[model samples]
Target: MIKTNRIRMKAKPAGNLSRDDFSVEAITIPAPASGEVLIAARYFSLDPYLTGFMRGWQGPDPRWAEGIVVGRFVAQVIESQDQRFAPGDWVQGEGGWQDTEVISADKLQKLEPIPGVPFSVYLSVLGSSGLTAWAGVNGVLKVEAGDTFTVSSAAGMVGGIAGQIAKKIGARVVGIAGGAEKCAHVVNTLGFDACVDHHSQDLQGDLATAAGAPITAHYENVGAKTLDPVLANIADRGRIALCGLIAHYQDMNPIALKEFRRLLISGVTLRGFRLPDFAADFEQASAELKAMVISGDITLQETLSHGLESAAGAFLNMLEGKGTGKHLLVLEEK
Candidate 1:
C-alpha cells in the first residue's frame, strides 16, 4: 500500500478564491490492477481554467467538481501492469491534484526524452497550452506574413506562445500585458514588435500607437476590459481566436463588450476554441513545438511551487497575475 497526498476542494468559492477553500489530504492506494499503472506525479499544471472549475462552472470534463480538483500532470510510472509501460517511464496524463495515482495505462501518454528541453515542458509548451496556441494561431486565425497580429496577456503561457508563433510566421506582432515588467519581457524576450501596458492611463491610445497598422488578427486571452481596446483597433475582415477569458473567471459574469457592434461593422471574425478540439493533431503539433524549442525558435518561462500543499497558493497566485510564464506545482524531482 502507498500513501498519497492530494488537494481537494473543501468548499466552492463565493467570489475570489482563497487557500482556505482547499484541503490537502492523504489517501492510501492498493497495487494496480491489470492494464493499470501506479504513477508518482512530479508536476501539476496550474491554469486559469481550473479557477472556473472551482466556481461551479461545468468544464469540458464534468469530473472537475467540488471533490478533487482536476488538471493535467507529469508523472513517473513507479509500477505498471501493462506492457506498454515499465517501472521508470515518464508520462503525462490527467492525474489531477494527487502526488500518486492509479490510472489505466490507456489514458497515459508515454513521454520520450526531448534533447535539450526539460521534462516539465510536457506540461507547458509541449502540452495543452502549446496546442491551444497552435490551434489559435495556425488553425483558427490563419495568420499570414505581413499581417499585424495582436495578443492579449502576452506574458501568459498560452498568449506568450501564440505571440512568438505569430512572429515566426512573419507577422508584425504586438502584445498587450499588464505591467511595465511584463510588457518589457513580451517585447524584449519574446521578440514582439511592440508591447502595450494595459495598466497605462491611456490604454486605447497606447494600443493604437503600438499597432500603427490595423490589427489583422487578435488572440484574445483576457476579456472584459482588455477586449474593448483590441476590438477598436481591428482591421476590416480581421480574425480573432477567442482562447480564454481570464478576466471574467473570478466573477462568473458575461463579458459585456463595449465594441460588440464594431465586430459586425468591420466584418471581423471571432471564433472560440478549446484545446480538445485539436486532439487528433496533438502528436504532430508536439513534434513541431519540440523542434522549435530545440532550435531556439521559442522560449518558455515558469513559476514553480514545490509540493502538493502549495498547489492552492500557486493557483491563486496565477489567477492574480503574480507569476511569469507557466504556473506549475512541482511535487518531486524527476
Candidate 2:
C-alpha cells in the first residue's frame, strides 16, 4: 500500500484565500480495480478559480456543491488494470489537490509524444488554460488578420496564449499585466506587439498607447477595474471573449462599472463562457496547439513549486500576480 498527500480546504474561505484556508492531509492509496488506474500526481496546477470554489461560488454550475476543491493536474499511471494504459504512462486528469489518486482509466487523457514539445505542455499550453485561450480567440472572437486585440492578465496562462495565438493570426496583440517585469515579458518574450502595466500611474494613458487603435477584440480575464478600461478603448462593434475574472476573485464586492452599458451603446459583443462548457472542441484545439508548440511558435512558461505542501502558498502568490505563466506544484516523481 502507498501513502498520498492531499490539500483540503480548511473551511470555506471568506475573502482573499490565505494559507489557513487549506491544510495538507495524508491518505492511503488503494489498489486499482478493473478499468481503474492508480495515478501518482506529478504536477498539480494552482489556478485562481480554485479560490472561488473555496468560497462557495457556484461558478457556471448552479447545482455544484459549495466549498468543493476541484482542479486539474498531470499524473503518471503507477498501476492500471485497463488495457488502454499501462504503468508508467503519463496522463492528465482532474486530480484535485492531491499527490496521488485512483480513478477510472476513462477519466485520464493519455499524452502522446510530440517530437520537440515537453510533456508539461499537456498541463499548460496544450492543456486547459491553453485550450481555453484558443477557444476564446479562435472560436469565439475569431481574430482576423490586421485586427488590433487587447488581453487582460496578459502574463497569465490563458492570457499569454491568447496573445500569442492572436499574433499568429497576424493581429496586433497588446497585453495588460500587473507589473513592469510581466509587462516587459509579454511584449519582449511572448511576442506581443505591445504590453501595458495595470499598476502604472497612468494606466488609462498607457493602455491607450498600447491599444494602437480602437480595440477590435478584448480577451477579458481580469474583470471590473480592467474591464472598464478595456471598454473605454474598444472599437465600435468590437468583440469580447470573457474568460476568468481573477481580479474580482478575492473580493466579490460589487464594482459599479460606469461603463457597463458600453457593450450596448458601442455595439460591442461580450461573450462569457466557462471552458468545460465547450469541452467538445478541446480535441481540435489540442491538436492545433501541440503543432504550434512543437514548431516553437509558442512558448510555455511554468513556475513549479516543490511538493503538495506548497499548494496554498503557490495559489496565493498566483492570486497576487506574483508568478508568471502556469503556477504548478510538483507532487512526486513521475
Candidate 3:
C-alpha cells in the first residue's frame, strides 16, 4: 500500500486566495479497481482561473460547495488495472493538487511524446494556455498580414504565444507587461516588436508609441488600465479578443469602458472567449504550436515551484505581479 499527499480545497476564499484555503492531507492509495489506474503527478498547471474556483464559483444556481480539491495536473500512470494505459505513460487532465490519484483509464487523455520537446510544454505552450492563445489569434482576432497586433499579459504563457503567432502572420506585435524586466522579456525573448511597461509613468504614451500606427488586432489578457490604453490605440475596424482579465481580480469591479465612443466610431469588434467551448479544434492548435516551438520560432519560460505547499504562494505571487513567467508546481518524481 502507498500513501499519497493531496491538496484539498478546505474553504471558500475571500477576495484573494490564502494558504489557509487549501489543506494538505495524506491518504492511503487503494487498489486500482477494474478499469482504473493510479498515477503520479508530474507537473501541475497553476492558472489564474483557479482564483475563481477558490473564491467559490458562482454558476446559474450559485451553488458554493467545498468538498473536492482544486487544480489541474499532468500525471504519469504508475499502476493500472485497465488495458488502455500501462505504467510510465503521461497524461493531461484534471488530477487536482495531489501527488497521486486513481482515475479511470478511459477518462485520461494519453499524451504522445514530442521528440526533444520538454515535457513541461504539455502544461504551457501545448496546453490549455497555448490553445487559448491560438484560438484568440486565429479564430477570434482573424489576424492577417500587415495588421498591428498587441496583447496584454505579454510575458505570460498565453500572451507570449498569442503575440508570436500574430508576428508570424506578418503583423506588428506589441505587448504590455507589468514591469520593465517583464516588458524586456516580452520584447527581446518572446520576439515582440515592442512591449509597453504598464507600471511605467508614461504607460499611455509608451503604448501609443509602441503601436506606431494603430492596432488592428488586440489580444486582451488584463483589464483595467491595460484595456483603456489598448482601446485608445485601436485602428478602425479593429478586432479584440477578450481573454483573461487579471487587473480586476482583487476587486471584481468591472472597469467601465469610457472609450465605447471610440469603439463605436472605430467599428472595433470585441469577443469574449473561454477556450473549452472550442475543444474540438484543440488538437489542431496543439499541432501548429508544437511546430513553431520545435523550430525555435517561439520560446517559453516558467516560474516553477516544488510541491503543492507552495501552490498558494505561487498563486499570490502571480496575482501580485511577482511571478516572472508561467507559474507551475512540480508535485513529485514520476
Maximum-lDDT candidate = 1
lDDT tens per residue, model 1, 87-189: 8899998866888889999999999888777788998899888889998998899989999999999999999999999999999999999899999999888
Residue 235, model 3: Cα distance from true site in angstroms:
0.6
Each prediction's TM-score versus the true structure = 0.95, 0.92, 0.94
Model 2, span 238-300: residue lDDT tens:
999999778776776886786888988899999998888778998899888988897767888
Regions of candidate 1 where Cα sits further than 4 Å from its true position: 57-66
Per-residue lDDT tens digits for candidate 3, residues 134-232, read 999998998999999999998888898899899998999999988888988898888899998888887778988988988899999988578778788
Q: Candidates' lDDT values, in order?
A: 0.88, 0.83, 0.82
Clashes of each: 0, 0, 0
Q: Whole-model lDDT, candidate 2? A: 0.83
Taking every candidate in turn, the Cα RMSD to the unseen true structure, in Å, is 1.7, 2.5, 2.3
For residue 103, model 2's alpha carbon misses the true position, in angstroms, by 1.6
